[model samples]
Target: MASTIKPVLPTSYKAAVIEAPGAPLKVIDVTLKKPGPSQVLVKVLACGICHSDAGLQQGHFGPHLFPRVPGHEIVGDVVKIGGGVSRVANGDRVRGTWHGGHDHTCRQCHMGLFQICDNAVSNGISQDGGYAEFVLLRSEAVVRVPKDLDPAQVGPLLCAGVTVFNSIRKMKIEQGNLVAIQGIGGLGHLAIQYANKMGYKVAALSSGSEKRDLALKLGAHEFIDSSQVDPIKALKELGGAALIIATAPNPKSIAPLTGALGAAGKLCVLAPVGQLEINSFDLISKAASVHGWPSGHALDCEDAIDFARTHGVTCLVERFSLDNAQEAMDTMIQNKVRFRSVLVMGSE
Candidate 1:
């Protein structure tokens, strides 16, 4: 059950703050403020380090202010709610989407597209994020977590899971449609599993043979090595992939797969590639569409978690204590973190 007690005495909370770009995070003591009206105070249990954090840290995603705590994949419990906040109660297990709080007055909101709210502020980026003992969120951004889900393992679901879910949902692949997932890493692995559960003929594309067996074991029906042979030709001979999901950062690695998209097929880019140079005439002739789907709304995020639960979708997470956050981040940077990396907090 969620706790509703509002502690009266102000107490210091531990937080990991990135003082500057490329600088190490500093652990600091902070005084957490009580939730104001329309706000809820969450005691963070775990947060997944996403590639977006790498961009924020390297200043690749524009100028993020200093002293920012870069973690958007947050799972926690609502400990307190401000006056008039009724969506969640104290002690509710919860997670927050990228939108910290969205302004419902935008045109997008009227169309039920609040995820693209013009005045939206995001967690860990536009606002203080989850790399702390406590964080504040507007009531609208919180998604109630299933009580049975493990807090640590569910952290990456906020971003990685939702990204793959949203992408696959948009693809509308039939049960036997040929689908290929590029880069069997964090997002790719989950994409492969999700696609398989969605009833698609799943294939995995990677640079090396190392991930070939793992990909097949993770529900991929076939695996292709871009290094050994032309993945486009291989996928073409395999009846061409109807839907290709690119989960790697390098656009060149995934660009060729555009040709592998059979007639009227689709290529979804989940990773933020620097740029994609495509043969427009070829794409137009094949009637292939290139799409990009970022994180979805709070409700969509909930749908993903519920779907995962129903389908037994899970992240193969490597756990690290909160104190080892730096090591965890380093592992993610080196792409050595198997599947996913999550920080575990609270008493076990």
Candidate 2:
């Protein structure tokens, strides 16, 4: 029993597509299909260009199917809803994340770990995403967003925001604990604000001194330039870190930070950086542990957005048009973007 109010369906729409690996994304017209049961058609308002998009386009995440639309952090309006869909309705603002669709019967799903479900379907990887005028999203994967929140800023919250927020929440660090956020990039910037707002003594660590002011402006109590000093020794001097969240993707940068943890300290890695050459003795000596957290489910995304809204935390974004997606993604890949790059589709 669903209401049937739909927008004028377009026969085709513009999309930025990757025809092949290592090829530039081309803006082209693609045919559209009516959403099937349990699905909803979204008029994409904005989408965040994440580092993962660059990795997928470069085939770093293994071989990818050609002609894919690569953008996972999606924010849009539910224009049409198919039968049996009641989670959202037409005119409702919604957001979708990396955790798209999954089999509800799986053990992971039953336990509310939909992000790690055995048959999880990635929105932009396994299927088409919001690098287009319109996107068809599985209803179950969609979460209602606050209508008052800026659509452009909330897109990254669907992925990067949720990932870091969930990871920090899992650490269960107490208030006033010393927390170190490594790499003042997209994820690190948000992590710093979140940790500080959560009552932790936040320290922002990066390779150079360029981001010192920016980090402090984002609520960090201190900033450490790793290139000028030994970061481990620096942290130890300040009573060590109760929690260190590594957002930098380079394993070399992460390996040394492991030794900066204090007794019973936890090191949480949010980057997709491939393996780390950690000294086991360092971990054993401090009774510390290293853990990795992936993106969260819809409820987690909602929680992150709510927390950010209440605390005035937001991502600093560079805007781009759909036609300029290549340039936007290139800027992100080169690490030239101030923080995040978002493709704004059109006005709401």
Candidate 3:
């Protein structure tokens, strides 16, 4: 028999760890295990700080194990691969999203709904994530990224990008449809770009006039300042939105926008705000619908990256070092980040 070669692994690495719920993340040394079958070790180059991470830290996503390294929008290079891993190899650049690993035999997985697999492992939530110098990832959760793209810019796409893409794709909105994106923050900015590129007559809906220029710059055909004018009326004047993507986390901000939808219009909530109160009359009269969309699996992330690359869509990011992860998380939580915050490690 030919000799079998085993991949060498690192003994320890640095990580930003949350010791408790509602506590600040601290950098700590952690030991690593060799990649098991179907797993790969990654040297994290950049990791995006998302609102979901804040929610998880604040116990909003339910109970989480302590000392967790919270990050899902991970971009890195594969350092080692375990047995049976075939998707990626050593030295390959890749990205990982919220959908970690899934049991292939599950009904959801069998039906190609891998994002909602009955037994799914969540990166950074259920297990250690990329808020570290290194992370061990399931090969099934990794997607190859183009080497030409900047790692820092690509990190947020793994989560925020794939999320909006999957949601918009599911809507099947036709070209030239009036689509409004509420909130010009991390998710909204990307949604606007995607909506515009996908051939929608895009409208940017935000709280103030300040984002009007930015929204237009991102390809919004029209900007609706919700603070000064009624967004519902403004959108109605534009023939009403055929599809409204609610990216703002505040339910109060979203409830009114529900009325902005035209007949058979759909409101897709990408942000996870609790307990929304929509007028029953709006749904009954206009036949409107409201629903939530979680992030997609790795293949969806690949498609998002490909589309973004082709359309020149990129994230406006504030870079933070691995040591300053606490500040990064704080900036994201306080809504101070312009669009997205990414932790840069190693050379990039």
Candidate 4:
């Protein structure tokens, strides 16, 4: 299939493009192209700003990765589909996630691990993403979403919301187990609600009392103020966490939580930060382990969306225009967004 094909029409839309490393996002008019075979073209309604976008700005995943439109948590309406596409039709509400496009013939794909395909294409990294008026998506990565839902609110679910919901369901712990979320930020806030709705004993762990009431209001059974006390000792007092989800992107804060894992428990680290310091004996004694999770595929994203919508798991989001894409990304990376930052298009 053809990739990055040019449009016949001249200057059809505007996008927030990263002109170069360390440069601010520039909104410029561009020719919007049609989808290739097995591809879909979407009119973007909203796209969430993720902290991971900083990697694209800082030239981390490089040699030649600039002029890219950085965004992955995309919520939009399908406007066109290329040949060989049968899964969805025009005007359908859909979401494009991080697992942009996958080569289905790879060994990992054969095992149903499309997210880690040998030639996995990541939206916003491997290709232009939803930081624009329109985005082209592989048919396999387009998840059909609810039309009635708010695009700004549901956009994050395609990433942050799904990351937690999908990973938590796949965790070794079962419902009603004590699940602790170690952060009160973007991913952590959603994690609390999902854990509670999924029938777990939810505990929200953070550095201060500011988020204590907010955590309980979001369904956490208890709030562990790590600023006033040791979160590890507190989780241990609650009989140890069956699962501790480290959403805070600091390895130092995450590593010590391993000591609070119960027998055969798991510490699921979601952040891709620095290396974690863990004692082998601590895990060996309890049969516990630390691991990371990549966000799920389109079908899994569908499940996450359905669960959140059905259970009232709403994402708190701050809105920005496509012109302010740089500010949105900056705010997200600086942890200034109350939860998630989304770029809203056409007053949506």
TM-score leader: 2
**Candidate 2 local lDDT, 47-78, one digit each (tens):** 99988888789987666477799998899888
Question: All models: lDDT?
Answer: 0.84, 0.89, 0.88, 0.88
**Mind giving the per-residue lDDT tens digits that candidate 1 earns over 18-124?**
77888776778888888899998888989888877767778765564777877888898888889999788988988976867888999988877777889988888
The digit string of per-residue lDDT tens for model 3 on 1-348 reads 211443465688889998888888989989987789999988899999988788778876666477689999899888888999988888888887788899999899998889899999989998889899899999998888998898999999777888888898888778899999999999999999999999999999998898999999999999988889988999999998889998888888898877889998999998778788888899899988887777788888889999999998888999999999989999988889998999999533
Residue 76 of candidate 1: its Cα lDDT?
88
Q: Please list all clashing residue pairs in model 2, or write none if there are none.
A: none
Model 4 over residues 144-177: C-alpha lDDT tens digits?
8888899999889779988998779888588888
Q: Candidate 1: which stretches are off by over 4 Å?
A: 1-10, 62-64, 346-348
* Residue 101 accuracy (lDDT) in model 3: 94
lDDT at 57 for candidate 1?
79
Q: Which segments of candidate 4 are over 4 A away from where they belong?
A: 1-11
C-alpha RMSD of each candidate structure in angstroms: 1.7, 2.0, 2.9, 3.7
Question: Sorted by lDDT, highest first, which candidate order results?
Answer: 2, 4, 3, 1
- The TM-score between candidate 3 and the true structure equals 0.95
